[model samples]
Target: VESATRTAIEAIRTGIGTKPETEIADATEAEAPVREVISLLGIIDGAESDILVPDADDKCPGGYFHCNTTAQCVPQRANCDGSVDCDDASDEVNCVNEVDAKYWDHLYRKQPFGRHDNLRIGECLWPNENFSCPCRGDEILCRFQQLTDIPERLPQHDLATLDLTGNNFETIHETFFSELPDVDSLVLKFCSIREIASHAFDRLADNPLRTLYMDDNKLPHLPEHFFPEGNQLSILILARNHLHHLKRSDFLNLQKLQELDLRGNRIGNFEAEVFARLPNLEVLYLNENHLKRLDPDRFPRTLLNLHTLSLAYNQIEDIAANTFPFPRLRYLFLAGNRLSHIRDETFCNLSNLQGLHLNENRIEGFDLEAFACLKNLSSLLLTGNRFQTLDSRVLKNLTSLDYIYFSWFHLCSAAMNVRVCDPHGDGISSKLHLLDNQILRGS
Candidate 1:
C-alpha cells in the first residue's frame, strides 16, 4: 500500500509544481509503518524489485502521497487530503483546510483597534481613515483640527452624541454635516462659524437630532428654513450673535422648541408675530438691546406661556397699555431705560406677574390705578428714579408689595401731613423752613 501511495504521490507531484511545509512534516513521520503494512497486504506488486528512488531535486514537483489500503492509492493532493510526505516532490500542493471565521474576525478587530489613539482633531481637517473613538460608552467626540470645511464621510455609522466645538470654521456649509449618520445631540459652540449657508442644516431635518448649541459665533441672520422639516429639536442656544431683527418665520418651524437665548445684540424692534410661532417657548432673554418702545399689539397672545422676560439696559421710554401679552409671566425687568411714567393699564393683562422691576428710570409719579392690576405683585423695585413724593393712595392698592425703596424720594409733604393730623398732639408740630418749600427737621 505504501509503495502504491508513494507512486501516486510522485505522479501528483509531477502534475503540480510546489510542496507545502505542513505536508512534508506529516509524510516523514508516518512513512515506515505504512510501508510495512502495505507489504503484508500484498499491495506492493514490485516489492522484490529494487526500484531506485532519486533524491528530491530542485526541479521535482511537490504534492501529496496516496496509498493502496482500499483507501484508493490516489495522491493526497488530488483527493484534497491535508497531508504530504515523499521526498521526490509528492504530497505537497493543493491541500484544502477549513478556516475558522472567528480567527479572521479577531484579526480584523485588532488591526484597526489601536489606530484611534493617534487621532488629532481641530476644526476643518477630516480624518484620513473612517473610524470612531468611543467616549465613555457610545458617545463620539469628532472634532477636526483647524477644519474649515466639513468632512466627506463620518467616522461611525451609529453615533448618539457628537461634539464639534473649538474649530476654525467660518461658515457652515450645506454639505458640512453630510457624514453624521444617526446623531442625537450636536454641540457646535465656539467653532468660529461666522455665516450659515442657506439650508445648511437641511441634512439633519429628518434625523433624530434633539439638542443643538451654536452659541458664541458670528451669525448675523438665521434663514427662514434653517431647520429641517418636522424637526424634533427642543433646545437652541443662539446667544452672542450679530442678529438685529428676527422675522416671524425665524422660529416658525421649531414647533417643539422650548428655550432660546438671544441676549447681547442690537435688536431694536421685535414684531409680536415673531414669537407667535414658538408656542412652547417658556424662557426668553432679550437683555442688552437697543429697544426704545414696546408695542402692545406687537406681542403675540401665545406668549402667555412665557414665564420670564428680560429687557434690561435698553433705551426704552414707553410701554403701551397691555403691552405684556403674557398672562403667566412671573418675572419682568424694565430697568436701565428712560421711562418717565407707567400708564394705569400697563400691567392689566399680566394676571400672574409676581416680580416687576422699573429701576433706573425717570419716573416722577405713579397713579393709584397704575398698580391696581398687580394684585399678585410681590417684589417691586422703584429705585434710581426721580420720585420727589410718594402718593399714599398709590400704594394702597399694592397690598401684596413687601419691598419698597422710598429712600431717594424727598419726604416733605408726606411727613408734614402726618405731624399736623397727629391725634396724640403731645408737642410735635409741622415746622416749615422759609427757604423754598423745604420742611425743617425738628431740633
Candidate 2:
C-alpha cells in the first residue's frame, strides 16, 4: 500500500510539471479524488474495522456476541439471520427491539400459553416455515418425526404441551428442557428411554410441568432425585417399562403428585416408606407384576389420600392381617392370585372400601371375621375360587353388599340379601332362592 501511494504521488508531481498552462487547473482539481482512494485503503488495513479477533477469558470478545449462559460466540453478521446458533436459541430473540414490545402484548392478548382454560388438544397446523413441528394453540406436536434431539430453531413462545412421541431419546440429560419452563405436559411415549440423569428435571422445579408420560420405554430404574423436590408434577406414568425394583428414595418430596402408575413391571416387593412421602397420592397401580406376598409391615400407613390400589394378577399366596392399612381406600383389587386363606381383619382398616376383588384365586377357607369390618363394601367378587361351601354367618354382617359374585351357587347363600348374585343357577339354586341348593343348607 505504501509503495502504491508513493507511485501515485510521484506520478502526480510529474503531471503537474508536464501539464501546460491551460491543463494545470485540471490536475489540481484531481487531488481530492486521490485522497479518497488513500482513505479507503486505510479501512482495509484493520485501522477502522468493526470486527476484532478475540483473546480467551472474556465472555464475548470485541465484535462477537455471546450466546446467553453459554460460552459460544457468534459474529455480528449472524445475530438475526433467522438461524439458531445458540444452545438456548437466544440470538434470534429481541432482533427488532421496537417490535418486541408490541409482539409480547399481542401474544398475551391473542394466544396466551399455559392458560389451562384457553388450551385444548386438537389438530395441529404449521405456524410458519421456520418450525419443523406443527403447532396448534399452545401445543407443539413432533410425533413420529424420527428426531434424535429436540429441535433447536423453535419459535420463542411459551409452550404448554410438547409432544415428542416416537422419538429415540435413549437418555435425557440434566436441564434438557430448562429453556422451555412453561411446558405443562410432556409426552415421550415410545422414546426408548433407558437412562436419565439424576437432576434431569431439576430446572423444571419452578415451572408448572404437571404431567409426564414415559411409558413403553426401556428404563430399568430411575436415578435418585430424578424429579426435584417441591415440584408440582401431578401424574407420572412409567408403565410397561423394564423397571425391576423400587427404592424408598426414588420418590422423595413430590407432595403434589396425585397418581403413580407402575403397572406391568417386575417389582417383587415394596420397600418400606417407598410411597410414604407422597402425601397427596390418590391412585396407585401395580398390577401384573411379580409380587409374591403383601407384608403388612412393608406397606406404608401414611397414604391417607389413597383411594384406589390395584395389585391384581400377581403371585401373592397369602395376605397378612391388616395388609391394607389405608384409611381412605375405596377400591382394593387383589384378584387373580394364589391366595388360599383370608386372614381375620385383613381389610379392617379399609372400612371405607367400596369394591373388593378377590376372584380367580385358590381360596379354600376364610376366618369368620375376615371381612367383618368392611361394612361399606358394596361389591364383593369371590368367583373362581375353590370354596364349595362358605359359612353363612361369616358374611351376615355385611348389610351394604349390593352385588356379590361367586363361583358356586352354594356360596351365594353366604351373601344373605345381596341384590344381584352371579351364576344364576347351576342346575340347583336360583337367584331368588339361594338357600334352595342343598350344599348351602348343609353349611
Candidate 3:
C-alpha cells in the first residue's frame, strides 16, 4: 500500500514539473484549490509548501493520507515578514521576486560608489537593474518619468551630474540616494513630490552637494529634518511648493543654507524664531504667497545678516507696529499684495535696508513713521494697489527712499496724515474711504 502511494505521488509530482514559461499560469490555476485547503487548516504557507514539498509519501495508501498534521501548518501574510522578505506572500510570484531581488542587489552594490567614485551621474526613466550604466565622466539627464517613488539606485557615473525632474515622486527614502555619494549637483524640478520622509538625504554626507533644485513640486509642507545632517548644502531651491507656513524648527539645522527660493507659495504667516536659526542664510525669495499681515517680531532677531527678501503678490492687509526686525536686510520686495495700510512703525528695525518694493497693493493710507527706521532704504515701489491719493506722510521718513510707485488705487484724499500715535494703531487705512458711512469716490 505504501509503495503504491509513493508511486502515485511521484507520478503526480512529475506531471506538475517546473516550467518557467508555464509556472505562473500553472500556479494561478493551482492556487485556487490549494488555497481553499490551506484556509481550512488555517495555513498561510500554501505557496511555499507547494514549492518545497517532495514528490513522495511513503506511509500512505491510495495516494492519500488523512493524517492530522494540519495543526502544524502556518499561514504567511503579505508584507508581514520581519526579515528581508518583508512580504512572504509576494514570494509566490516567481517573476516579481526575481525582479525585485535583482533591482535591490543592483542598488546595494552601487552604494559604495558614492564614496569611492570621484564623480557620479544619473539618467533614468524606468527603475530597473537592467538599465544601470557604468560611471561616466559626463552629465546625466533624467526628466519626465512620472515616478511616484524614489528609484532604488542613482546611476554610477563619475564626474557626472543628476537630473531627475518632472516626475510624480511623492516621498524620498533615505536609501534611495546611496549610490550617488560623489554627486555635486542634484536637480529635482517640477517633480510632484509632496512629502519628504525623514533622513531622505542622509546618504549624501560624503558628497559636496553644492546645488539642489526642487522647484514646482507642489509641496504643501516639509518635515523638520528634510535636509541632510551636514551643512555642505549651499543653494536650495524650493520654488512653487504651495508652502503656507514655516515653523522655527523647519530650518534649525540648515546653518549653511545660503540661497533659498520660496517663490509662488501660500505663506500667510511666519514665526519670529523661524528666521533666527539661519545664521548663514543670505538671499530669500518669498514672492507670490497669501500673506495678510506683517509682524516684525514674527521674524527671528538673528536675521541681521539677511541681504534680500521678496514678499510680492500676497494679501498683506496691515504692517503691524515694530515689524521689520532685520537691521541689515538689503533688498525688500512687497509687491502684488492686499496691503491697505502702513502703520508708523512698519519699517522700524530695517536700518540698512536698501531696495524696498511696495508695488501692487491696496494702500489707502501710509503713516510717516512707517519708514522711520529705514535709514538706508534706496528704492521704493508702490505700484498696482488701491491707492487713490498720495499721503505726504507716506514718504516723510523715507529720507533715502529713491523709487516709489503710485500708479494704481482710487485716490480720494489729497492731504492725508501718515502717522498714528498708539503702538496698536486704529484701523486708519480702511477708514480713509468712510466720509459719512459711505465710500468716498472709488470705494
Candidate 4:
C-alpha cells in the first residue's frame, strides 16, 4: 500500500506544472484507481477493511446490506442478484459462498454437491436464499449446525417447533431455553448431551409442549420434577442412552404423557410407583434392557389407559401374577427372555390382547386354559423354546388364533420323533398328534 501510494503521489507531482483544472482532474482520476485496488485487495485477502462511507450515505451504519441501497439491520442474508448496492458496489463481491458449499460436499458422501440445499421435510425447512421463512417461528430447523453452545438470543414468541438435532451440545444448562417460552416441539436428538439440568425445559410451560426427543445422547439420569406443574408433554423418547434405573419422582409432573420410549438402554430397575403420575400413558417400550423383573406397583390402577407394553430382550425369569394391571393392553411382548413357565392366571386380564410374543424363551410348560380370556388373541409366537409335548387340547380354545408358532407345529404333530422337535426320544414324546392340515408358514 505504501509503495502504491508513493507511486501515485509521484504521478501527481509530475503534472504540477500543467494548467490548474486539467492537472487536478488527471490526478483525481489517478487516485481513484489506487483506492479501488486497495478495496479489491481486502476482498481477495478475506480481511476486514477500514473503508468508510459518509454517515449520511450509510443509512444503516455498520449493519447488513438488506436489499438495494437501504442498509437495514436484520439477520444476515448474503445470497443476492449480486450486482450493486453501494456507489462502488462492494456488496456484490464474494457471491460464490465457497466455504459453506464445500462443507456440505464433504459431509453428504456418495452424493453430488448441493444435493441437500433448501430441502423441506414435513413442517421443517432448511434455509434458502431467503434467510428465514415467511412463517418465522412456526417451524425453525437448525439441524447439523455443529453448534457447541445454546444461543441466548433465540426466537421466543409464538414458536411452535424447534429442531436442533445433530449439534455438538454436551449438556443442557439451566435457563438454556428460557428465552424460547412458546417452543412446543423441542427436538435435540443425535447430539452429545450428557447432562440436563432440572429446569432445562421450564420455558415450555407457557405452551402446550407435546413432544420432547432426547434420543441417542449420553444422559444417565434425569432430575426429579423434570417438568413443572401443568406441563403437558405427551411423547418422551430417551432411546439409546446410558440410563441404568428410573426413580419414582423422575416423572412426577408428567400426568398427560402418552408414549414413553426407553429402548436400547442399560435400564435394570424401575422404582415402585415410578409411573404413578403417568395416568394417561399408552405405549411403553422397555425392550432391550437388563430388567429381570417388573414390579406390579409401577402399573398402578391409574394406568387404565395403557395399551401396548413391550418387555422383549430382557432377562426376566418369572412374572408375578397380576403384574400387568393394564386391562386394555392389546400387545404384550415378552419374547427373548428367560421365562420357563406361564402361570395359569398370568394373562387372565388381557381380554383385549391381540399379539402375545413369548418366543425364544425357556418355557416348556403350557397350560391350555391360561389364555382362555384372550379371545381377541391373533398371534402367539412360541418358537425357539423347550416345549417337549404336543397336546392338542392345550391349544383347543384359541378361537381367534390364526398364526401360532411352536418348536415345529407340523413336525411336532406328525412325529415327535422328528430330530428337530425332540432331538432324541430321551425328552419323551415319540408320539404324533394332528388336529389341522396347514402348517404355519415362516413363523
Q: On residues 280-380, what C-alpha lDDT tens digit does candidate 1 reach at each position?
A: 88777777778899876767898657887778778998888878878888778777889998777788877776777787899887766777777776556
Better of 2 and 3 by TM-score: 2
Better of 1 and 4 by TM-score: 4
The runs of at least 3 residues in candidate 1 whose Cα sits more than 4 Å from the true structure, single-residue gaps closed, are: 1-145, 149-161, 181-184, 405-443
Candidate 3, 233-333: lDDT as tens digits: 87777777879988777765678888777777888888777767688887777777777777756666776677777777777777777666666777777
lDDT of 2: 0.71
lDDT of 4 by residue, 196-270 (tens): 888777766666789888888998998754788778799888888999989888887788899888888999987
- RMSD to native, candidate 1: 41.8
Q: Write the per-residue lDDT of candidate 2 for residues 1-443, one digit (tens) a residue.
A: 64444344445556542445445454335444534533532223322223333358655653356677676766443455466666678766765433113222322222123333344544433344456677766677778898878876554547767878899889887857666636778888899899988888787678778988888899999888778766789988888898888988888868888988887888887786889898899988887789998878867888999988888888999888887879998888887899999977788888898888898999998888888888988778888999889887778668777567788754655664554455533543222122223343342
What clash count does candidate 2 reach? 0
Best by lDDT: 2
Between which residue pairs do clashes occur in model 2? none
TM per candidate comes to 0.58, 0.67, 0.57, 0.61
Give candidate 3's whole-model lDDT. 0.56
TM-score of 2: 0.67
For model 1, what is the alpha-carbon lDDT of residue 286?
79
The clash number for model 3 is 22
A best-first ranking of the candidates according to their lDDT comes to: 2, 4, 1, 3
TM-score ranking, best first? 2, 4, 1, 3
